[model samples]
Target chain A: MQYTVISLQGLSTENCQLKTEKMELKEKLIASFMAFENLVDIDLPVHDVRSEAIKEFETQGFPSKRDEAWKYTSLNSILKHDYSVFPKRDNHIDYNDIKKYFIHDIDTYKIVFIDGKYSSHLSETTHDGIDVCLMSSALTKTKYRLIIENYFNKIATKDSLTSLNTAFSQEGAYIHIPKNKLVAKPIQIVHFSTGNEAALLVQPRNLIVVDENSHVQIIERHQSLTQNPVLTNSVTEIFANKRAIVDYYKIQNDNENASLIDSTFVNQKQESFASVHTFSFGGKLTRNNLNFYQNGERIDSTMKGITIIGNKQHVDHNTLVHHIEPNCESHQDYKGIYADSSTGVFNGKVLVDKDAQKTNAFQANNNILLSDKASINTKPQLEIFADDVKCSHGCTIGQLDESAMFYMQSRGIPEKEAKALLMFAFSNNVMNSVKIPEIKQRITKIIANKLGVNIGFDL
Target chain B: MLKINNLHASVEDKAILRGINLEVKAGEVHAIMGPNGSGKSTLASVIAGKEEYEMTDGEILLENENINEMAPEERAHKGIFLSFQYPIEIPGVSVTNFMKTAINETRKAKGLPDMPANEMLKMIREKSEMLEIDRKFLSRSLNEGFSGGEKKRNEIFQMAMLEPKLAILDETDSGLDIDALRIVANGVNKLRSKDNAVIVITHYQRLLDHIVPDFVHVLFEGRIVKSGGKELAHELEEKGYDWIKEEVNA
Candidate 1:
């Protein structure tokens, strides 16, 4: 947010214009909710949920820096964009043009969207052994009503941005794996903003349910196609039943004019496992609110992220693990590399209930600032009510090792390439957790390119 | 051939190598023996163009060209190799892949195309086999989790791959067992040629027994106090560095 100078006498014309624009953006969204209500089925339970959510958004308004949770991130700058609350039309794009962003080297199920609407031509969904389809279908269809009534918006916290996203939740991926079933291939739910509007805000909601003894892998991304400003407020809800496993990855590499505030809520039953890996390398302003609720005993939760960014871009990773039952474990490891004037924030909070005993939680955040102006704010908060819990957290911020640089250079690698190699090695441990080869290859290329080195040989 | 004329260098504003003069001709092996903190490693680093070492007043010439302005990698491309006493561990970069990058970078500096993939692999297999390195070891991260002897062996493996015109072994034998010492010294001897030279920097005479030097020089207080034939190494080992200190103080 740009804080322009103001005279004590009165408001200037430019300041007035920006104020009205932001006010109009918020007012416009509130006004558009009424019109938006007419487009969907008012008979479903989600409609009431949406109605209540919009009211809560109206009461809370957009968050400011005053909120402790948002002390390091401010939305005042992106709010100035006069965003179109709802996309008007879908922009047709060729497959060749957008193919590079997908894991095209391998065969998988894809749920593609243009702006906020599903693009059937580019999607490869399945209903053979699992239900990998659209949320719109799950909401309006009669067969999915029971599941929707039980799981929709069940675990999402009622924060202002999440409430705003839920208020207009429509059109996103919905996957349901039955008991004793294993998804043969990974699922990629990619949202492409055509940037058809002068300024745009798209809200995509995803729901996933994995039954007992089931396993699934899903990848998510949000991309803007043009230089026009785009703001995305997305919410995803996942429920893992007993002995179920879920692996979800989010790739946030959008155009410089785009911003994203993604809120994900994961609820796990007994003996269930859920892991979320976020690769944040782009976007003008990105905030991830990931919350895991271990509602049952013996649940395992994992969170890992690698954020490499430059320019004026900013990324904030806010995570929480709530242990309500006993014998649960959670691990969080996030690494970031910031150059130019970019900034990053990592706020991880872990809470253990009084009744929960023998809980193990680990948190680590390490960062490298390549430029003097680049910065990072990291904090780890643990509130343990149980005396028998085990918790450890550590964070470090520093530059590259000079001796290591000279070591590589003396081996004939240039200074620029040597730095890239060290940076690549710094994040390589997290990459080891990825099971998919094609995804690994894509992330490797992105890291290499971002580090400004070709690395012609395989890693 | 490598030549240094009144070379003066320092690190962090502290003088390390003060008024040091040395010259090594091709086809000759020179041994630099010094006590602890005698600026032996500093000379190796300065010759390899380590940025931390500030060259205050000196001239380093390689093949009649002044190399004071060259970067470490640039000096490396000019065929000067310094085997570090303590090699840096770079995780996620396999030994083979690191050698490939180093070879390609040096070739690129010399305006040559990348070596063919098959030739590179063949060369790697031959050199690795010569150094008795396991095939599995080639794929592990460079120097990460490697034993002391393994790190020293890997340095020689790199030297074999680069085949520099001048090779400086900085305490390459400090951490090696008898078996590993013989293997590492054998690797260095195999690469030594009439067009290349070797500079062995060590504190003891055991490694000098394997990689025998033609000339031995004693460094005291950043200056070569005495130069002599190979017998000087035995005298230093027998009498210890106190004799050199006594001689220099006298």
Candidate 2:
């Protein structure tokens, strides 16, 4: 199959001007590459990959509306800011001040980053049977060289944003689970932007490899400590070996001044199961590019997300599931609630290869618009080359069910609470599949908080 | 202890309830029997303060207080309940959670704290057992994929939990088998007391057989044409609604 790469200049003049401005930012990023490399080890083998990535990003500055893959989401406005590539100093954050961000109800391994640098005082890493440490260590240390050589940047797409992240990759979580070993506790990767700069841009790259017959669960979040403008361009590549099980959760509920571009790539081997759940509640702008590649038969790839936004918040979810082997299955369900002038986009594509016969792929995108100004653009695309495969896609955009509202109101629930309950129920299907009880509860609390309700229950 | 004085209501400029006058005393059961399009359900909805209906005239009094301007939930807090003919299916809320929210909201409106968990659980167990509902059914999503009988029974179960002053069962007997009908009627019978009243709106007398009503009113073309004792249901059953329609037209 052939993929077309549309030129950014083909767009309208307005978009072209925006892209031109972003091109300046891209030059600034290219000029700062030497400074970034000077901070890290220049002799490391990963530096070559970084150099190549920077060259690729230079060739493709930033994707614009002209690109077919970026038709619904535009990055020109966010890229206009002159973002500081690195913070001048390491900001200290007291654990007591930011404890509310963590799921304190349970014990788990945590990899914490403050202002794009690792915070040893706030992080808990393990070096026992499994490796749960920083990507910087994994890149420099000889003990982890084999894993790094085998899996670093292996499955991540070479898009301009991802390439940019690869060019600036220095500090993020790096986990390696050995064969036949199950990680007892879920790992939490949290990056907190202190907002010390006028406008800061942080690129965090994570590598996770779970070997055969092992299981691991990971929760990742990007939070902003202040109202200053902070943009995070993060990339995570996960590889699940044969018979491996991996559950990944992303919680994106930051302040209004914060924006994120998250690119996650998952490669699953034979009989492996990998599920990624993204809960996006608050942000000025969020674009999630989630891709799943099934490399072997009987693999299961599940992608689910719930987006609830109000005000002028904008969220875009662009997902792709590529089924290459026969008998593999993929399921995608996304639910969104847009209120006020908030806008949402869901572009879900499932591609079944010719040899992927007996592949069962189902995709569903449902959204509710609360205000007259709120809008959602949802498209589900299924490309099935195999005649015998079962591939179906469905998309719906609607308001809240009036009858359901009346039912709850008549039962003594107020209008606001009733609407909240209906919205909760609308997204409850995805929440039910969350494996960790504490994480599920935490997400439920965040949703309730977003809805501005103190319903005395867990919901 | 409910009274409707010259009640006239319409929906979208189309008149449905025309000058309805009725009274239900405490410790009494009133069965409002009518054929289709006779406005029986409209009267129930208007009495419960369904906002779609425009009460163009007359007053609805609950315990001698006018409730025409009250919201549905306000009326519910004031001891009014309307069992929907077709219960709405809420896909994600469990039956128990729905009931819990309903009960707590009502309590909070009355300036009372939420019911304690153990007490709430005990009440749920007792009421569900009264309706013969399985323990597993309480955890299922509210009314989603529920059998017709299960939906009706769940309605009565909620009525039992709320213990309202006046409960209106609108077409509750429809879509229910004889066993489910008997079970639901038995649950209602057990909850009936001198301090509360019930208004059963049905086309058939099967439900009245289990929960006997003191007065049976025949409503035709938005007006109550005839009112009698329990024997009126038997007469209406023996002779269909045609007699009542003919009498009203004459």
Candidate 3:
């Protein structure tokens, strides 16, 4: 019952017991839900749904290494900070200061949030053809009530952190594409933490639905402005109807004090296609929980990621693709480069039901360690009850090829540039699949910058 | 232009090159012919500053400068090029881009700016054309899934582009067909000049028929046991290397 009793025993036995006692982050968040309910209407669906979610969080606190899903990543290091449950949102940022973080070269529909508050001046949301707007309006508006009630938390798993986000979170992006409609440009959802509090915790929720024969592309990012500690628990639900095409990208390049736990659930219907690409370059600790469920036949799911980190930073990618119908296919490829003392983990799972016959699944994870202290743990799990399914997986961990280095050097290329080129070649297959030219170009520049080289041309 | 003074080298503590003392003057093509495990490739790699090959004792002099302390790229900037037997496959980098990076890096080392794009393209066109390479081949990833003849031709194309002062071709004719062999040999012959030297290391006497050598040396057990004019290669070709091994063991 008393987690910090050992450290308290060494302190003075004072008279003020209330001041001496410290509240756990779990207890603070559970208590903050009450204040959260007071601000909104008491009789609305939000109050009851949030109350149920808080109960789930109270029952199951933050996950530990003992859990099978979190065997490699531990939340204890980030949970030790005394984060403010509610942060002030009076900070106004200059657009020029944060322009580099977005894909600014091309026009994009931006849904910008600063310190957990929606920024109207920085956002460009419209309701002319499709519903591209804020989650607050989606959750409260009468016209959006039925759509939200039907799809809002429908596909998300019952994970503890996701439940916690659903309990206390109130603001994020809500995108809905009508049937047979393709958005003119890509949409960017960016969350910036201003470091207004000593330490802050922000939970964001997003819901995206693509109707039949529609197409959509999305890019998401989280950035912290200052060095103060910040933790963000975000959840996103995506629905891809029949014959729809959806492409999603997650870019994690926050500062050292920032940590993120992102959970995304995707549902694909008959003859639909969905893909998610993650690029992780910087973070103190980042955990990605991505899941895909095939609802109908002949669906395609693809997952790809490239991670490069150093200096004690950590990143974990946990993904699952469930095949509920027959003739579905899934592909997963991830590459990581760790230097200094950084660590990484990749846990991918594929499951097929008994009736899901003739399914094909492939997974590959490759990593390079630039320093002896850097490490990675990769695992691929497959559970197939259908006898006609084909599943394959491979994992590799190695250093830069010595003979390749010597070969390049003999061709008059320096050691550093040669290494960067080899890394580019390592991740070339995944980079080739990016559809947006501007996004691909931006990612190339970021990869070059992360490698500390000035590569100005296409690979 | 190149001198190896009693060069002693080893890989993983296993002595591969023992007391190799050979001098190659400018404008001369020196053919090193030997059987398997005769240190022919080791000699080529040692001169190119391969880190895995430790030079235990002796010196490698290029144009009167000791290059034993230089790194591989440094040696390359000084105009030493090694055409590997199996060229590395660098995916996602086209042949043109690889050549541009290599040439620019060398130029940058020599206190010059990057070559203009038009001039670089022109040089690539000239070199590739001289080798009779297909224009479509230049845009593909460098050596990835390439045919053996294509790989060899690409290697020669790169050699022509760099134009090193001391060119060491290590078994460049192994994986090539006869036509590719002729084209590659012609490319090498065209790049020969009065100021640069060439060291041709091979196991078969077939490639020497095209790229004729001025001097022929027979290597056995990490040492050159016999040295002669071009007639020596013909003699070795007529009679196999068993005669050389018998002579060395005697």
Candidate number that wins on lDDT, 1 or 3: 1
After TM-score superposition, the amount by which residue B74's alpha carbon in candidate 1 deviates from its true location, in angstroms, is 2.2
Q: Which stretches of candidate 2 lie over 4 Å from their true place?
A: A1-13, A456-459, B242-250
Model 1 vs truth, CA RMSD: 3.5
Q: Write the per-residue lDDT of candidate 3 for residues A349-449, one digit (tens) a residue.
A: 99999989999999999999998888888888999999999999998999999888998899998888899989998898889889888888988888899
**Candidate 1 chain A, which ten residues in sequence have the lowest lDDT sum?**
A1-10
lDDT computed for candidate 1 = 0.91
Fraction of true contacts reproduced, model 3? 0.78
- For model 2, the chain A TM-score is 0.96
Candidate 3 contains a number of clashing pairs equal to: 0
RMSD after CA superposition, every candidate: 3.5, 3.5, 4.6
The digit string of per-residue lDDT tens for model 2 on A1-459 reads 112234656656766577678878988999999788778888999999999999999998788776888876777668889899989999999999999888888889999999899999999999899999999889899999999999999998789999999998888999999999989889999999898899999999999999999999999999999998899999999999999999999999999999999999999999999999999998899999999999999999999999999998999999999999999999999999999989899989999999999999999999998988888888788888998988888888889998788778778888788888899899988998999999888988888888888785544
Chain A structural similarity (TM-score) per candidate?
A: 0.95, 0.96, 0.94
True contacts kept of each: 0.85, 0.68, 0.78
lDDT tens readout by residue for model 1, B52-171: 899999899998899999999999999999999999998888898889999998999899999899999999999998899998999999999999999999999999999899999999
Docking quality of model 1: it rates as medium
Model 2: which docking level applies?
medium
In model 3, which runs have C-alpha deviations exceeding 4 angstroms?
A1-23, B242-250
Please name the candidate that would achieve the greatest DockQ relative to the true structure: 1
lDDT of 2 by residue, B1-250 (tens): 8999999999999999888899999999999998899999889888877788999999999999999999888899899988999999988899999999999999999999999999999999999999999999999999999999999999999999999999999999999999999999999999899999999999999999998999999898888989999999999999998887777778
Better by TM-score, candidate 3 or 1: 3
